[model samples]
Target: MERKQIRALGRRVKKIFIEHDEVKRIWSRFDGMRTYIKLDQFEDEDEEENDDDDKRNLFLTGLSGVGKSQIGKRYAKSVPRYTEIIDDEEIDIIPVIYVELPYPFTQAEFYKEILKALGTENFKKEPTVNELRNRVFHLLTKQRVEMIIFDEMNFIMRTKNFDNQSAMEMLKKLSNQLQLCIVCMGTPQIEKLHTMEDEYVRRFGRDRIERFEKCDEKFCELLERIEKAIESPNPIGLHDQSTGLPQLLHYYCQGRIGYLHLILKESFRLLNVYEENVQVEYSEIRLTVDIIKQAKFNLFRKNDHLITPDNVDKKEYMV
Candidate 1:
């Protein structure tokens, strides 16, 4: 394989998205919330979707690498913005907006994130919190944004100086004023965010994506799905119990999808090296346990625990 082929394969592998059961379910939940803000459901696009409970806002929490941010991003991309003419003014109808909060996520920063997602100014120079908040509302309304996905919402709790109470108020206002179904996605610490305010607790319908406790049947199924999704001339057989690849992967990734993805991507790239070094056809090459082991070593050499010899599981543990 030449250098060009190797780089192409790298880019191709990164774009592959496997919509496993959990991911599909998350999309369904988000689509349902979207209906509440659609013109078909409400008399007007900005009409109130939240009743007394305000549970229409969705809160997605999960372990790191369970793909919470990916889910939000992919779902947002599924809906494309278009042009709408109102009173002879052409407004960009961005149906969904995905915003990732900056580290030390604060109230002013939160407001600016929305503007950034809308593709206007990514930052406002020293605008007051109230000023930024109002700008967010005005732009969201003008653009007719039906949904806002706030990724890394958990950072609110980790930062000491951030006024979460004020941020909560901003979220509440964003939901009610714009009739947007606000989706907050982050790690488990974000669960504490709802607990801080009783009203917020009632206002949010929460869902947690429980990661694999350990390598089990569910993890095996995930491997099978990933195998089918990979753009290879032949199957990688990641889930084949006889090959012992699945358990070995479990040992390294600990059931985290993000880590699993990284490992597989690196392993695929290794195929290029093996072919070039051996002066063999790419079609004759395969993803062997040794190849994956080397990829893991190259990837996690600094991390240490992920790249040892004794951890290799060349046998099945299915009970």
Candidate 2:
């Protein structure tokens, strides 16, 4: 296939989203947060924030590329920011702020991430952390931002000896000071925060998007869904027990959905329906195990141990 055609097909493959159990759980959590925020009726006559039942925030942890970031982005997109006329000025009503915590993160960077998500960060000249923090709070309140998703929160935990404790405290502070829902996504290391005796630790719900533990019936069910989405010319019977493909794929992907997605997308690019390879009854081209076997090498550039000959041979037993 030509490079142009291959890329188009690859993009289509990349766009597929199977609402598996994990994904469904994420969506439910996100929607629950959204609904709670809408129904939040806690109030205080005096100058105080009431969080008696404001545990709508979420801390989603998982392995890298395990779909946390994707779900975060999708949820943020669902409640898109928009401009509205209030009084006499155009106001930016950003319901959700989605920003990735920059690596080598600092307290200043933390504030800037939120500012950047709000589309109000001054890039030409850097501002003091104090200034940025004030601006973040002000803008979040002014724009009616309800939820703030801090993706790649692994950096926030490390802080690299740079006011690490204070930085984390900032997350808690944001929730209390602004009564905002704080959603964070990152590696499982971020879950360490739960062990601390923070004032608001219990107010944050925790969930993890884990990889498949086995190539059992559940994994085969996912394969069946992916096959349907791939819209391949002919059904590959990936879920068929006779194929022994589920086990092989579970091994290849280390049960990681990310690697499985990468392999399937690359396979789409490799398939040649009209130009080369086998054509079924002069009608349709079919995906084969051979193509997937070749696609495994496309990742890691031959660096991953999972793709090494020894590992592959051992994992073959699962097939």
Candidate 3:
């Protein structure tokens, strides 16, 4: 071939090689296993014929990174599509609104945060907490919100004794008065919502929402899918059996969905930046590992006081 022709052929081959490699890597990252779709269930907006004005609630409990938010997003997507058809108008759809609970030092602060979220800036000027709450409720009700996703109920769980009780009461009241489906997405601590006082537990019905548990098969399937999504040749290693991808991921992220996404995105970006022969070499994996190790070390080192027996309590392993 001529010089120009040879260069063109080489460029085409490189593109093909990169595409093939990227495909495998992406597949490993987002296979169906970890994505949390019920194979038998189809996505539909009108899955539940909930009153448009009334809020429909569902709680998604899981470890920090086991895919609850992804499921929440999927459900959020379906709501707008279904509502659009039902309303038969070009209705504005926010689709989903995610709000992490503000860290509340005082019971009063909890109410203040809720007021701020609902745009009631001068809430303290209001006559009563109930009045301020009512005003906020009316505002949200006017927005035609389909659902309110509380992304970090764990924050409330971690509150001090007095603040914890008040926060829980406010949460329960918010769900009841708004009649919105309040999906509490949080870590394992959220289970306290179930085992707590009867008054709080009564509203969140036992059958309404369940906690997420990782089965061995499902976990392995998720790992396989993540590997396929990331196009990793050996997505998992034999060492994974004793401290496999799932365990490592759980340890690194506390199985939190948001953390997992963040880590995976960073890992993928690193892979893209350091490609060799159209593949992310083992060195890239080592780099990611080192990064995680350092992070774990820093967290344990800095937050030693928080690492009580009730908490991570693995300071010795941090090294």
- Report the C-alpha displacement of residue 294, candidate 1, in angstroms: 2.9
Estimate the TM-score for candidate 2: 0.82
List candidate 3 stretches off by more than 4 Å: 1-59, 81-96, 105-132, 206-217, 231-263, 266-319
Least accurate 10 contiguous residues by lDDT in model 3: 206-215
Q: Model 1, stretches more than 4 Å misplaced?
A: 1-5, 39-52, 122-126, 213-218, 233-235, 271-281, 301-319
- The better-scoring model by TM-score among 1 and 3 is 1
What lDDT does the true structure give each of the candidates?
0.76, 0.74, 0.46
Q: What alpha-carbon RMSD in Å does predicted model 2 have with respect to the real structure?
A: 4.6
Q: Give the worst 10-residue stretch by lDDT in candidate 1.
A: 310-319
lDDT measured at residue 66 in model 2 versus the true structure, 0 to 100? 70
**TM-score ranking of the models:** 1, 2, 3
Clash totals for all candidate models: 0, 0, 29
In the range 189-222, model 2's lDDT, one tens digit per residue, is 8777654655546678878888776677888999
lDDT of 2 at 214: 67
lDDT of 1 at 235: 69
- Per-residue CA lDDT of candidate 1, range 1-120, in tens? 455554455566776677877888888988888875664453665865446645459778987777887888999999988998999988888989899987887777777778889987
Error of 3 at 256 (Å): 6.5
| Cα error of candidate 2 at position 317, Å | 6.5
> For residue 295, what is the lDDT in candidate 2?
81
